[model samples]
Target: MTPDTATPSLPPTPPSRRAEFRFDGDAREYFRIWIVNLFLSVVTLGIYSAWAKVRKKRYFAGNTWVAGANFDYHGNPVSILKGRAIAVATFIVYSVVDNFFPKVGYALLLALVFAAPWLVVRTLQFNAANTSHRNVRFHFHGRYPEALAAIAPLIVWPLIGIAVGWNMSSLPASGTEFFILSMPFIAFAAVYPRVVGALKLFHVRHAAFGEARFALDLPMGDFYRIYIAAAVGAFGLLIVGMVPIALMASLSPLPGLMVAWQAVYLGVAAVFLAYTRSHVANLVFNQARMQGGVRFVSTLTTSRLAKIYFGNLLAIAVSFGLLVPWAVIRTARYRASCLALESDGEMDGVLAGVSENVGAAGDEMGELFDVDVSL
Candidate 1:
């Protein structure tokens, strides 16, 4: 064969660059801001909380850096205030009606349950729209229908269980009657992992950083495995933790017994919560991918997270919450340290996407209702 006819070798692949997330927030600096925010909110009778929220988010976002770029928050204080006002009004109405008309209150509760999915969608959209990195805004395109579909199992089964139990109580109780009443709840528990997986998938896939879409192909089995393992580990830890409590109860006075019980409870809770949080976060982030050859990595450890969480609890208890800012900083720093963005030398090539204005009413209402649907 002629020399020109010989096959040429392929070019070598570019090295993958890893940019770890960094939080440069100073505890002392944040404490000053936090104190001012607290004082102002109290003085204003909580009306200033909207401004406080924006300031806090901006501070955190500005401090969070990755790949030589820091994040920015562009939330409007007026919008947030409007949202808070609406939330307050809704709460007042609910309280007043619930006090005067029990049946109407139940009906309103049902309405809220159905409206939850829409509120979650709006909350996600509003938060994403307000956050930016390197001048490129993030966006969430999830819709109410999608949100409802993703979480239907979680909502429906519990409602079914309640309805069943309510109606069954009027009938004569039999051996299988309890099981019949409990079936919906058991089903709900069994499907919880799948529902969570679905929600995460919906959240990640619908999100975008600029025009580049985020991706996640996490398996349902991963959620189940993590939760099951955490449950078993928690049970084991609870047994071990309770041994000292049991002994103290047998020998110690009432006050000491209460203290021992509380300690054991907090310890078990901290360990399990940390385990689930770390493992799930690592799994979700490590599996997440984005357009432009970008991917994610998370190295969160159960032991480290548990230490921070448990220590935060102890510190708050001892300092009467003066160390809240410090605890927040520590947790943010650790979480940032554990996460990274991996790219194949294309970080500078990604372009910004267009974003629209989103209202903050859903966000404030979600907070007031204790509905945390954030990703």
Candidate 2:
């Protein structure tokens, strides 16, 4: 009793090899926060989405951690607002010009539309540059060259379509004629994303990084496969449902019941599509690697994805659609949980950190600011 020499107990060590994911709390809690915020946002129209975006960024940043380091948002929220404002202003100005100076306006709109890819790339870079980690930051240099390369084909594609439309009048109206006329454009559009993504990855890889080299792998085949699968699955659903609907309609007492059934069928189909898309994205991202040959591995299975999709749907249904906020929270957590490191190790948790300046009201709408850094 004179000297209690019992060794002090230590906290349990997290698994050395654990899935890479970031989220500390249950999905339901986040869902609740999302709901309350969403309601306030809807009541105020779109102003709330901005505030909501800030809150969401904070929540996700605060909850996510990478490689034992928390991620932070160093970017200014005002920058996002500014960018959005510019985009809106540009759109309005373009509209007015097109309306007042028909030919000139058309040319200007065409030019702007052709430059759409560059605009998107710049926006992404700006957003990425705003994010930092451990006070150190990542920057996104504009990939103008790649953007221009991608845009040229996009601009030309419309001309091809117009030509086809003009010539169609002379061709016999047959199924084969339609397919022949459209197949090339369809194929081009289908393959365009992969081509553009590969170019973008190449540019991003060469971009500057702080103390680390940036690199990205372009798994074109896998990327295209996932998209094709989604498109095909959606088409398959539609085709499969038609038979059942036709049979049901023949036997149903009320004609209107077919319409209701169609609605239900479409709703279910949409949920299926969402679940499949998420699953495919998780799988693809997990398999893709960064510069250091560090491959990502996702723990999300088809069943788990289905559960998440249905869970969100149930939440929305139960709350008379008021639970959308909560559902989004759960959705994010589910996705985060599914994302993990593929390497062998016991997993503990993923961490994300975000530094933000809240206004006097502690609300995102009240002149909110943030700086994000991810590890």
Candidate 3:
């Protein structure tokens, strides 16, 4: 309508804000805490490690800030300790079974297979319940059926391998037999990327920050493409690395060639690891959203990430692992710098409705495996 016939105008929508993500942690401060934790853990024969983990989580969460508010971790050390004890006990039992009763090892193995999905689901729920920003906690609603489906590869692949090799009463006497036995393992390797992608989907897609759940439409097709690209890149790097080594072997001594081969292999592995991590981070963050209007951005470059990893490795080695606290802090800070959240409104408002506590049992897998996915 023209101005003559128009009613009162409404206010314009506010432009979105780019919420800054910052890490307020200081290496010196963390180092002091780390050293104390280490000493206490050792003094207590690793029992204090439970409390140490809680402190470490609290430290990181307390220091991480977005939209002028720091996040918080409310995980109990007692729960974590209990989880660790359970994990250790299970490991001991599994080890005993493998050592003494080879056939019964399958039963123990199947036990773990059935337990994997539950552990993962609980771990996600627990960690999400404990983590909070603006007094509201995140939550994970992944169910056992969904989790089982998502983690089937980890469960089924091993079972298939065991089934295929269960009759290995003696070493394979023929090449054909050896080839037949290895097929299950080969198939597992081929499907491993898909399994990882499924896990990522389960962890990320099921997460809810307040009432607004996360949505990631990263299909298996997309995930497979990313993995395929990374694999091809790694293979190319390996080929490139080996070509010169093969040609120059004639000019180098046997020991020198061996050293060169080792160096090339390690270098390729490092580069591949860095490349995949950076690429995956950028891909996932850019594609994912919390609610509809809240999105994430990642500026992590492969070169930058690789440098951080290489530097951290060197520094840790140089310090005989004493400087590990510094390395951890350094990596945390840099990674924080690479991420920013763009949202249509205040984040506190978005988080207002999402407050929850999943409980100690929810994060057992995280506590047990130390899978820290703080993004």
What are the lDDT figures for the candidates, one per model? 0.88, 0.57, 0.79
Distance from true location, Cα of 313 in model 1, Å: 0.3
List, in order, the clash count of every candidate structure: 0, 30, 5
Candidate 1 wrongly placed segments (more than 4 Å): 1-6, 157-191, 251-254
What is candidate 1's CA lDDT for residue 136?
A: 93
**What is the Cα-based lDDT of residue 53 in candidate 1?**
98
Who is ahead in TM-score, 1 or 3?
A: 1
Best by lDDT: 1
lDDT, candidate 1, 1-375, per-residue tens = 556876789999999999989999999999999999999999999989999999999999999999999999999999999999998999899888878975577567668778888888888999999999999999999999999898887787757755674567477768878788778878877888777788889889999988989999987999999889988998898898788778777786577677777887888889888998888888888888999999999999999999999999999899999999999999999999999999987787888988899999999998998776654
TM, every model = 0.92, 0.67, 0.89
Considering summed lDDT, which 10 consecutive residues are worst modelled in model 3?
A: 366-375
Ranking by TM-score: 1, 3, 2
| Candidate 1 lDDT | 0.88
**Residues 1-375, candidate 3, lDDT per residue (tens digit)?**
546875889998878989878998999999999999999999999899889988999999999999888999988899887777778777788889988997798888788778777777878877888888888778888888988887677665778767765777665678778786777777776776677777777778989887888987676776667667877887998899888888888676466887777666766676777777777778788888998589999988888777777777778867999889888998889889989999877665674455455545435544555433333
- State, as a TM-score between 0 and 1, how close model 1 is to the true structure: 0.92
Off by over 4 Å in 3: 1-11, 177-181, 246-249, 254-260, 351-375
